[model samples]
Target: MDKTLRRWAPLFVVPALICFIIAFLVPMIMGLVLSFFKFSTVTDGVFVGWSNYKRIFTDMDFISSLWMNVRFTIVTVFTINIFAFFLALLLTRGVKGTNVYRTIFFMPNLIGGIVLGWIWLLIINGILLPKGVTIISDPKYGFWGLVALANWQNIGYMMVIYIAGIQTINRDLIEAAQIDGANSWIRLKSVILPSVMPAITICTFLTLTSGFKIFDQNLALTAGNPARKTEMLALNIYNTFYTRTNFEGVGQAKAVLFTILVAVIALTQLAATRQKEVEA
Candidate 1:
């Protein structure tokens, strides 16, 4: 049976592999290749070497969008993790209706991103209407709106991870710390935190990547209104691709650069967090 299963394993995987190649790998490679050429369509592509890359750097909108995305990622990552960790700690205690609360908290994550953006847009605008303003009326408002929307959606998901990590901690270790006359703060600092390092790493990575890749929310909420001030990297790439004619190569170049940027940041974050986990 084992030998038969092993023999058929490749057969079972081949279909999925083929689908992935056609759906993702092929397009990704094509996009990378197209980034070095100029064209309105694949068939008409003309080799342009590094011109597309040069145009990407010179585009002020792209530069601003990249910076905005970086800022949003940093802010959202910290806010979401901190809040989620605290909520996890709370619910893991003797709290009543924890299951209900968990369900309620996590429901936001179940909503589609575009829908979430529109919902927040209405809610935020309703609040700001009293002050005679709207979310898209200013870049700062749009920035904070995206931050708030991201935190609301992600905090609950991160909380679940934290709870699982907290539950895995040895109660005996915590009791041992208490017996040594360690206060709650001391125990939390020296034991509970270290025990939850894995969860922290996972949550941070998710938040970081999600924050950086934000697009639907930015689009539904602001669509880079008031002169593209609130545009993020993903949305900027999107606009460059469709909104401007004959700039598809530049857009593709921006996308390749965006992919590299996200890869580097995520790898750096994982390395740093994994080191902390080992130390802890």
Candidate 2:
């Protein structure tokens, strides 16, 4: 049976491989090619060869959006992970109604991003309206609004991963650490945290990537309002592609750059975290 399954493995893999090529690989290749050309449509492109790339930085909108996105990603990644880790620690203490608390915390993640955005929009606006201001009234408001939305939505999910990690820790090891006179902070720093490094790696990767690729929340929450000061990289690419005339190539170029940027940052984070896991 094992030999037969092994012999058919290639056959089983072929269909999914074909689908991947069709669904992702082909478009990525095409987008790369189109990024070098200027055209309103894919077939009509004329090779401009780096002109679109050259114009990317000259657009203030793109620059503002990129900067905002960087800040947003940094803020959300740290805030979400820290809050989630502490929440996990709290819930794992054999607390009463922990299951109920976990359910309530995690329910927010189940909501759709667009719906979450609009929900927070109303809540935020309701608070700010008394001051005669709205989320879009200022870029800082929108930036913090995004950070809060990201934290609220993602902390629960990351908490669950952390809980799983915390639970897997050997009870005997913890007891031994306590017997050796290790305090709570020392145990967390030396024993529990080291044991949970795998979960940390997973949670960090998810939050980092999600922070960078966020779109619907940014759209529904602020829509890059107040002269596009709150714009993020994804929405900026969208506006550049659809709103502008004769800038499709530039949008494609921006997309290629965005992909590379996210890929590099996420991979670096994974590598760093995984190395820590190994050392731990």
Candidate 3:
């Protein structure tokens, strides 16, 4: 049976492998190659060496967007995870109506990013309209507005993961700590936190990548208003690719850099968190 299964597994794997190659691997390789060329389309690419990348570095908008995204990612990563973890702790403590609350919290994540952005836009502007300003009136306003939207959309999803992690914890270990005269804070530090490290790792990676790749919300909410101050990396890449002429290669290059940045940051986070994860 084992030999037969092994033999037939390749037959099942081959189709998916082919699909992956055609759908992802091919396009990815093409994108990397195209980044070094000037072209409006894949077929017309003219070799331009590293000129596209050089343009990206010299572009002030790209630099500003990069820094803006960095700041946004940092703030969201810490804020989203902290709130999610606390909420997870609360819900896991035999709270009544927990299922209802969880559903309500997570429903926001089910909303489309564009739609969610518009929803928040109205809500935020309603508050600021009285002050004769709007979310797009100031870069700081847009920045914090994005932060709020991110937290609202992500916290519940992260909470669900945290709850799952918290549930997996050995009650015996917690009880042992309590019997050892460990206080709640100490038990959390020594046991609960370490036990949930896997969940923390997953949540952190998701938030980090999402923060960096954010586009639809950035577009719908601020549209990089106030002279493009709120533009993020993804939006910047989009504007470069579609809004500007003869800059497709530059946009593609920006995309490659963005991918590399996200990959490196996410991998580093995973490595750091995995080292601290305790056996459950």
| Best candidate (score: TM-score) | 1
Error of 2 at 186 (Å): 2.1
RMSD of each: 2.0, 2.3, 2.4
Clashing pairs in 2: none
Order of the predicted models by lDDT, top scorer first: 2, 3, 1
Model 1 vs truth, CA RMSD: 2.0
Poorly placed runs, candidate 1 (over 4 Å): 1-10, 269-280
Predicted candidate 1 versus true structure: per-residue lDDT over 1-280, tens digit per residue: 8888888987898999999999999999999999999988877999999999999888999999989998999999999999999999998886889999999888899999899999999988998899898887889998898899998999999999999999998889998999999999998899999888778878888888898888999999899986999999999999999999999999999999989989997889878887876876
lDDT-best of 1 and 2: 2
Question: Residue 267 of model 1: what lDDT?
Answer: 87
Candidate 2 residue-wise lDDT, 174-279, digit = tens: 9999999999999999999988988988898899889889999999999999789999999999999999999999999999999999989778987898787687
Clashing pairs in 3: none
User: Poorest 10 consecutive residues of model 1 by lDDT?
Assistant: 271-280
Residue 23 shift from truth in candidate 1, angstroms: 0.8
Number of backbone-clashing residue pairs for each candidate, in the order shown = 0, 0, 0
Per-residue error (Å), model 1, residue 36: 0.4
lDDT of every predicted structure (CA atoms): 0.91, 0.93, 0.93
RMSD of 2: 2.3
Give lDDT for model 1: 0.91
